[model samples]
Target: MGQGQPRRHHQVPQFYLRGFADDSDRVKVVRFGEQPRTFVTSVKNVAVEANFYKVDWLDAVREDLAEKLIGKVEDAAVEPLRLLAQHGELTVQQRGDVATWVVLQYLRGRGKRVDSVGLQKLMLRADLALGGKQRLASRLGLDDSAEVDALWDSIVVRGELADPPTMRYSHLRTMFSSTISKVAAAYVQAHWQVVTFQRRRLFTSDQPVCLWRAPDDDPGVGLLTADAVSIPLNHTTGLVIFPQIPSGITGESAPTTQYHRWFLAHTWMSAEELLILHPDDELPDWLPAYREARLGTLGLPDIQQFIDIGEAWRTHQDRSQPAAEVSF
Candidate 1:
């Protein structure tokens, strides 16, 4: 690569889920000027199945997301893959501290596990954390702190030190804070008009789209697009607030439930070429966040059930005809 060469930016398709209160979300037209200062925290989704289950502005976003999730594929096999990809990484929260997180699978899976220290220390390569100052100090017959600190000159200069071994792992993955919202925005832009559901259409102001698409684009918008390239984002922060005692509610009436939207920008890797953002590949700045999930946890009803099922399936496969002794 030449010094002046520009880094290539990929125009990848992206999607995200935005949730609204189920009751309020049932309506069609949403007033654009509602205030939401207190709504964000009060209506936050309670934990579900030991995991967070925020409501999506599903009614509003379904039109666009349906298309993005399914794509325009006709083949059944490819459609399943696309569906898998859409549902693949639905929820992503930090598995451990930002410094110790080493796996994307945990954060982005259909159901993610809560962050833990043992997980942080399990998946890392043995090299970056190995033979480090603490290890060196213990291995080279030197127990004193001053002596180890003295020998760490080169390591410290190279930006590798976890004094007293706090947060010895560094986050090797590159995380985009706006990753979820971006995907949502992309879906809106691509299929907003062409898709609809139950006699309702996506929300769009009569603001001229032609001007929004023109060239010599206004730099002030900070969101630019060439006919073939677009930098759209999803920064919607839609939420509702219900006071413990709103005008109509009495002690007999239940307090209203408000919905909070997680405001996010559309986040994605611009340069897919060299972003070294794998969870397990790099050691975190903290020493404790690394572990791999052995393949046994994948089957339903646990490992014992899976083994029994596997044995039965094998026996069935070996039979020439519908068998009388298939339980073996």
Candidate 2:
């Protein structure tokens, strides 16, 4: 190791220590490969292997939840609120409030007869499952600590509505691999970079080797090194996280996070996708009808169309199930 020599990154089988709550508590062990290996050591051991990536939860709220809800319809009326999500740089908690508001407004416009109490219950349940708090208060724009505290206590009392499955480094790695593969597919036709997949000469025959090319001068090309691997954005899925939702089957207390070990998914998009979410960007084509329906501006017939669609989605979880369920 000479002074001018470049620091080496660890080869494959990347390991990391991740925390769900605090650095010392609720830590998650992460590894990347065809199969994940349990590391008795901490993530700090190979901290130098990859750059630490932080999640912008706000972007997640907009891109993962709201944007998907809005879909491909273009909506010009809710530009202000949309801008707030895009540029206001709201916190994860704030984003949760916004998502709740959007869903309630949509349901109401469809003559759902929703009220504040119902709204509070929905918000609280979502918050509990998704790992946020003060959602009811935040949605109501109430800064009262007493109200927030009371609500928090009530939420905790509800107990864990949906318990998460037993997670392991292998599960995380398997899911993250799917995340990258999906992203690669989306960007395959894009001009920025060309990534190709091919069979590798190795013992793990199931995993395909990824080869990418960047402009000769691009520094991001360094990501091609063996040491670089995905790390959880915020101790969870980063851009996407999902709760252990109960199966539709009745009386099944033992929750399964990912039905198939190799196929793992979270409730929302991946952290890699969030990097491209920009605030100023125009709403996608799907939002306009969604917004018009939510505001009751659409004709009676059009409103019913959205209502029916919403009902169908709720009934058929397969199409609209949270990203987590699909990813895992």
Candidate 3:
């Protein structure tokens, strides 16, 4: 609305499974004197996710990142979204190819009537052999790439794309480069305190936080607060969203599982105003216009309608006996 005001987008929180390596006991602490090399691949992943929300690090934070890394914070701001989106799309295409191969092979292996669901599961296997792919193709009587693509899309559109068929840690590690590591280390130096179980606690933030959670955590949930946020951790990376130390809970005094810490973190984090950023430049030429046109269109349902629908659905369900029904 103002000359220098930022554009705003309503944030809709979508959950994904946490991405983290299970081993937490072996985390190496990067002390202030440790030789800092490029950890770019790791930082790139964090940056890309942040980019989707259009968040820019504060100036001081950017400088700290630069001192620790090889590139500018600006590059981190833009590149992750562009690169990761490309990676996801390409990986999906490759998976489609693999799925086709497997389907053709499966056809030849069995004389039974084809099950679409089973075929879908076969495509999901880590190593579907060339022979299997061919057998499936022969059995299904399909020689078309379009059919494969269609089948892939049918499954992917249902959120299968969230968990890609082929995810290689090495392939992703290559993206971060050493520079990103330096930035992360620098951030750790300033804000994090080492705790038991090789975890770190974050105490302050000049701006909104950049959080990553472990895979064990629920993907759909984040701890939101005025000064903190919990993000899903990237797999095979050191980046994570540390819950703040609670009022009476020190790192050593905290519960054995640290589940209570996370619980408190979630309580505080969820209370904050969610910032969802969208920049016009991030979209293709036609998309911005399309998005604008969709706003205020007739088919759109507001929050009240959603609540009404939920109420109607509940009412339709068989209720043996009801004392009271609370509405959201």
Candidates' RMSD to native: 24.7, 26.6, 24.6
Model 3, 247: alpha-carbon shift in Å? Answer: 23
lDDT of 1: 0.23
- Cα error, residue 54 of model 2, in Å, equals 26
lDDT of 1 at 175: 19
Global lDDT of each candidate: 0.23, 0.27, 0.26
Please give, for residues 1-328, the per-residue lDDT of candidate 3 as tens digits.
2243323211111111112111221111111112322121221122122112222344533322312221223223233323222232223333223222212211211111112223333344311222233333565577886775554345322324233322222212222345334333332222222122234322111112333344553443222221223321221111122334333111122323454354324322321211111111111232111111011101222333433554455556636455588899
Q: Could you tell which candidate, 1 or 2, scores higher by lDDT?
A: 2
TM-score for candidate 3, residues paired by index: 0.19
Question: What ranges in model 1 sit over 4 Å off?
Answer: 1-42, 47-120, 123-173, 177-195, 199-328
Assess candidate 2 and give its lDDT: 0.27
Q: Which stretches of candidate 3 lie over 4 Å from their true place?
A: 1-156, 159-166, 170-176, 188-263, 266-328
Give residue 249's error in model 3 in angstroms.
Answer: 21
lDDT of 1 by residue, 214-270 (tens): 345443211123121111111122111111112221111111221110111111111
Better of 1 and 3 by TM-score: 3
